[model samples]
Target: MKYAVLIGDGMADYPIEKLGGKTILQAARTPAMDYIAAHGKAGYAKTIPEGFHPGSDVANMSILGYDPAVYYSGRAPLEAASMGVTLAPDDVAFRCNLVTIEHGRIKDYSAGHISSEEAKILIETLDAELGTDELSFYPGVSYRHLMVARKNLGAETECTPPHDITGKKIDKYLPRGKDGAFFSDRIKASMIVLELHPVNLKRIEEGKNPANSIWVWGQGHAPKFTPFQELYGKTGAVISAVDLLKGIGVYAGLDVIEVEGATGYLDTNYEGKVNAAIEALKTKDLVFIHVEAPDEAGHEGSIDKKLKAVEDFDSRIVAPILKHAQTSDEPFTILILPDHPTPISVKTHTQDPIPFAIYRTDNKESDEVQTFDEDSVKKGSLGLVKASDLIGMLVKAK
Candidate 1:
């Protein structure tokens, strides 16, 4: 049986008053998702484990059937894997973000989603000036970049995610604890180098948020993961625009498929991802398709954009995949859900359980849930399950 896992990243949300007290899932048009819920099993999954931050790295790891407590490392090492940056045993990887700071406040976490080209130039410049024998930087997608520190510097430091502290003062949130000074010093140095650079100057001229400083967080040493095929006995592929997801796929021994125009934003190429997934299923037993647009809109606290993202994901990604499974001769089991809740009210991730639906073409069993939404799925027969068990369920579905 073929398996498909569709993740609408950060698609879950709290009720918004602007949308008549309905969550984005409830307010948006998601016929394809609703159809899956109606014909199959709909329920909630605890994607975030207790005492763990609700980060995508942790959540997606769980969804991929690896317990975060056992195999999970920091977010950057995963991205480093995707970027082909090899990490030594004692080295730590950090997620380096180009952000906008205004009047001593964390103004924009993404620096207005700076283009990959401009970000590449800025990161390369930072590496030239600030990189030492102990520390180095590598550019990735958009404002997201990487910094590898030898000898495990700042591995035990407490650093805040820039998105978690948007618009807040950066003083209290700066890295603190063992070797924290090493990271904080470079962050300050980056501002001096980037603030007056030509890239920032050109961005400011265009009335856009300038990539003025680097915020480093999500640090860890490399992790060990059992290959997906060895663990589940199935060949698989992962398709996503985000480095974190691709990095996870890399560690899991899955094929990472890249699509043209697959930006981790609202303008990401939806059709391209869908096409890639369908093609992958021809040779692979399982395929994971992740969309980052909804989560990006959630972080920006844009209700209309999140609604559009949700609707677009359903119509563009889910509908086409479902159609392919129905028309194909081989039987298919499709699992649909989000990694976590980037609530519009909080503008950050919450550890709340996310709703999920599993539909099987070979065995079409109807559930009581008529639609796919937070409240509607509460009554599903599947009830609350562990996210780490989702892949097993999909694989075992008959």
Candidate 2:
């Protein structure tokens, strides 16, 4: 038997008035997702535990069957794992983002989705100038980067995610608490270097958002986890474009499959990811496929783009995987869901239970749910299951 867990990151949303008071999922044409709900079991899953921020690191960890409370050390450490940045016992990792600040306000978290090629040069320059014996910078995909601080410097400082502070002032959001001054000074110094760099100048010429500064947050020590195969007895692989998901796969002892042109945005290669998952499942017992485009659309607070992202995910990514699974000789169980709700109104992640659907090749039993939206899935049989239970359920499915 084979298992596949598909995640449309931040795909859940609140009802938008522009879409006739329908959520993006309801407004979008998601035939493949709707079919799963119509023919399989659908319900809500609490991916975000109480008292935890609804970040992808914590949410995806839960979705992959690990308890965040037990295993989540920090977001950067996970990305560090993906970047092959080894962390010592006392080493702390920070998520360093090349962000855009305008008139003291946080304008864009992704700095207009700066290309990795451009971002690499910027981060390397920051490391050479600002890096000390205690702190250093490592570049990852696009806007997501990393800073490792040895001896636990600034590990306890309170920092805010740049994406969460979009359109808000940076004064109150700057890193605070112990070692806050250290992080704040470095972050401020980054602007001087970045603002004058040729990269930012070129970006300005192109009318793109310049990565004028660095915002470091999500700090913690390394984490430990029980390997996926050891815990579930299933050899698995993970397919994603973002470092966080790939890092989670690394800690969980799963193969991380990278696809060309797999950007973590609307233009991401959906076909490549779909094909990767199908190929992985041919030899691996489980595959976790994640798409980040919907989340990016939600963060930008664009209802139309969010609709397009969801529809594209349904038609392009989900449909092909399901088709391949159906034609294969081995039986399969597929589970689909989002990490959390990045509501269009708020333009940030919320701690909301997301709708999910589970389909089995052999069993066609389903509930009254005919669609795969937040409201429609409330009628499903598996009401309000914990995210950690999802893997076990999928593995045990008949």
Candidate 3:
């Protein structure tokens, strides 16, 4: 049997009054997703375990069948793995984001989604100036970057994610706890280094948000993961534009498929991702396709964009893959869900049970759910299942 998992990252949302009190999923036209819910099984899955933060790293790890309480070390280490930056036992990898600070307040988390080309230059410059044997910076994609500190410089430090503090004063949210002052110092140093840099000047000239500072958080050492094949008895591949998902696949021993033009934004190449998944299924038993646009839109609190993203995902990604699975000779099981809820109202990740749908070509038995949305799936036959256990159900584990 073949398997496909489609993740619309942070796609779930609370009802928006502007959208007529309907959630983005309910407002968007998602016939493909609805078809799966109508023809198969649908329910809610608690992707984030109790006492865990509602971060994508933990949620996706759970979806991929690894209990976060067991395998999750930190978000940055996963991104580091995807970037091919091996972490030593004593090294702590941090997720470094190029951010925009205005008037001592956190203005933007993503620095207006600064171009990777521009970010690379800024990252290299930071490494040149601030990097020493104990601290180093590595560029990944866009505003997302990495900093590896030797001897766990800030392993115990508590730093808030920049996205969570948008529009808030930086002083209250600055890194705290052990060695947090060290991270705060670097953040201040970055503001000085980047405020007048060529890239920031150019961006300012163009009426764009300047990446004027670096925010470091999500630090941890490397984590050990059992190969996907060893755990599930199936070879798999993962396709995503974000480094974190790719890193998870790297550690899980899944093929990390890189598609041209696949950005982790609304402009990402959806066609290329679907095509890659179809091709990967030729050799692999399962393929995981993740799209980040919905999550980005949720972060921006743009209802229209989130609606467009959800509709595009339904039409461009899900429809094509589902058509292929239906036409293929081999039986295929396809699962669709979000890693976590980046609610439009909250504008951040929330520990909510996300709705999921699973369709099988072999067995057409379905549940009461006829649509794919937060509320519609509650009546599904599958009911509520643990995110980590979904894989076992998909693989029909004995």
Candidate 4:
């Protein structure tokens, strides 16, 4: 039997009241999703580490049937692969954002929501200035970039990232010592100068997307992981709209497939992305489908949009998969779950075990579990299973 994995990034983080006291699942009248939860067995699955910060990479890795402990690495390197910039063994790379620090404070951390067009030009300008033999800045998507430089020199420094929803993504950098302090100070100074650059000022005047500043956060270097092909037997592809996940797929030795016009925002084609994933599965053994719209909407605390994203996923990807199984006699195992909880309460990911349901080809009927949530899933027979073990559950079926 073939396998199909459906993953929603950071979808389970939000609680009912967390997103203004309404769960995206509850907020949206998702009849189809609700039906699946009611008709099939459901419960909370412990897919994350206890007390650890939740991230898309970690959660997805877990759900894709990898042990987070055995196959783990810094997130920046995964994202860096998408930018086509390999990090040096002695270089430290941080997932950066072009943010506006005004009056010794972060006014807008998303570099004023710079558009791709403007972001490209700004990167060119930074290249002219910040480009160096050692330190290199390569821009990714809006407000995302890579800050790479020689490691063990001034690289073990801390950044003032809005790691938490309440904390300003740019607060202050914590230095390990005078050297780190010096490095941070210079970086901050450079960012300050970048803000005042004439190129940015011109964009502001022209009402163009102006990414006139910079901030650094989520810093790290290359890390090691068990390659996907080496562990999962190689017949899998990662299909996602976001380049970061695509990049991770690329590095993990999984086939990375791109969708036509798959933007990261609401306007993206939900059906198109799902269809792309389905088509890829015909040629591959395992398919990792990453949907970012729910997480993005949850981050903005947009309950309506988050609900829309969830329903859209059910109607688009999940439904098609289910339909394919129903219409054909082919045996396949499908699992549906979220990477982590992205509770709308604070518009950030949380380290809570998410709800999930799995359907195998052998089961006479789905389990008697009902509802999918942190609490609901705990009542199931398979209690709090690890991500790595999910493969065994499906692979052993039928």
Candidate 5:
């Protein structure tokens, strides 16, 4: 038996008056996903456990059958694992974002989704100007960078993710705690170095959001996880553009496949990811494919773009993979769902349970759910289950 899990990150949403009171998932055309819902079992999965923040790090961990309360260290450590940045026992890894701050407000979390080439230069300059024996910067994709502090800093410091503070004044959300003063100084110092840099100047000239400052948050030490194969007794692989998901794959002991043009945005290489999954499943027992376009659209508060992203994911990614699984000689099970809800109304993630569906090529039995949306799946026979139960249900059935 073979298995594939496709995640449309942050695809879930609340109803909007603009789309005739329909959620993005409900409004979008997702025939491929709808087919799975109609022909297979569907249900809601609570990816975010109680007392946990609605972050992708925690949610994806849950989806992979790992309990976040036990395995989740912090978002950055996982990304660090993917980047091959080793952390000592005392080091704390932080997600360093090159953000746009204007008029004392957090204007753009991703700094207009700054190009990786440009961001690499900016991060290098920051390291030259501010890095010391204790602190250093490492560049990843786009604005999602990293910083390592070689000290055992307590995690009590309150730091707000820039994406969550979009369009809001950042003064109240600035880092606050025992280590707040040091982080604040570093953030202010980065602005002085980046504000006049050629990259920011050129961006401003082009009427783009300038990445003028570095915002640091999501810090933790390294984590350990039993390999996916060991836990489930199946060879597994993961594909994603974001370092965070790739990082999760790293600790989970799965092969992290990198596609040529896979960006974590609306313009990502959708077809290439589909092709990658198909090839990986030829040898691996399970493959996890994560698409970040819908989530990016949600963060930008673009309803039209989000709707288009959803449809593209269904047709370009879901359709091709489902077709391949159906034609394969061996029996296969495919699961589809989002990590969390990036609701258009709030322009951020929520802790609500997400809808999911699993289609078995060898089983003819199915539930009555006919559409793959937030509301319709509630009537599915599979009902509500913990996200951790998904992998067990899929692999154990085989």
Candidate 6:
């Protein structure tokens, strides 16, 4: 059986033009997605669980058949993996971010969109000056980066993520350690010095992002995954809008291919991504397409942008897949789901269950439904689901 899966970001709600901005799903015209819900089965599924701050790495891993409970570290090590950074057993890692704090408030949280070249230079400089047996800086996407190998150094360190968009100060995250006062102070002090370095100021003047603030958090290590060759007897491939997702795919032994002119931004090759998935289906047994525009737009608090992303994904990917399924005689089954609910209000992925659905000839009688989304799916049979259960459902359908 051929399986096609489309993983959207956040499929949550927001105030439409009635308030100020357009709800992401409402703003765009998703004729294709509309066709899927109309012709195929549509329902809501809890892709994430409560209490856990759901992010892309854990959520997608759970959805892709791997039990996240068994294998979940943090996003930092995945970033390190994507960049080919090796991790030893004693090494500790954290997701590092570049932030601009103005008067104790985050002015430019993403370090003004730091590029690879600028980060590489700054990383090299930091390594030259602060580089030691215990200290290291690994560059990642924009403000979200990684720092590793702090063993035998100290403990009681916390990370200040500039995640809170309009908060008074950055949030501190420390997984676990023995000392609180001693190690925390040293890490805080070192980061403060990095924030005020003269080298970063030069970056600001050059119209590039400043590596002013180093907000390092997300304490986690490596996670093991069961290879698809062993589990499903076929190789798997992955495509994602985020580096961490790509990193996880690489770790799980998947072939990573470019979507062709993908910018990893809003309005990023929407139809192109779907077409790329379709093409990959011919060669690869399993394919994953991740879209981040919805989550980014939600965080940006741009309702129109978020809605457009959802609508476009439906039209460009959902509708086309439905049409193809009607004609193709291959073993085809389609699954559409979101990692978590990134409400426009919080602009982050909540543990809330996002929408989901399955369409196939085998379950056509058992899975007849219409109108997808959270509210509409509640009226149907598919109830709340754990992150680990999605793969089983796919297997059963096949």
TM-scores, one per candidate: 0.99, 0.99, 0.99, 0.87, 0.99, 0.84
> How many collisions per candidate?
0, 0, 0, 17, 0, 7
Candidate 2: worst-modelled 10 consecutive residues by lDDT: 389-398
Give candidate 1 misplaced runs (Cα > 4 Å): none
Worst 10 residues of 5 by lDDT: 149-158
How does candidate 3 fare on TM-score? 0.99
lDDT of 5 at 230: 87
Tell me the spans in candidate 4 whose CA falls farther than 4 Å from its real position. Answer: 17-22, 153-155, 160-179, 193-210
Global lDDT for candidate 4? 0.67
lDDT of 2: 0.92
Question: Model 5 over residues 222-274: C-alpha lDDT tens digits?
Answer: 99898888889999889999999999999999999999888899889998998
Question: Residue 308's C-alpha lDDT in candidate 5?
Answer: 89
On the 0 to 100 scale, the lDDT of residue 381 in model 6 is 59
lDDT of 4 by residue, 288-378 (tens): 7778778877776667778788878778877787777555466666778888877777777777778777765545465656655555566
lDDT of 3 by residue, 1-398 (tens): 99999999999999989988999999999999999999998999999999988999999999999999899999999999999999999999999999999999988899999999999999999999999999999999999999999997898999898888888899989989999999899999999999899999999999999999999988899999999899989999999999999999999999999999988999999999999999999999999999999999998889999999999999999999999999999999999999999998888999999999999999879888889999999999889999999999999832
Better of 1 and 4 by lDDT: 1
RMSD of each: 0.7, 0.7, 0.8, 3.1, 0.9, 3.5
**Which is better, 1 or 6, measured by TM-score?**
1
lDDT of 1 by residue, 1-398 (tens): 88889999999999889999999999999999999999999999999999899999999999999999999889999999999999999999999999999999989999999999999999999999999999999999998999999987888999999999998999999999998887888999999999999999999999999999999999999999999999999999999999999999999999999999999999999999999998898899999999999999999989989999999999999999999989889998889999999998888999999999999898878789999999999999999998999888888665
TM-score of 5: 0.99
The lDDT per prediction is: 0.94, 0.92, 0.94, 0.67, 0.92, 0.65
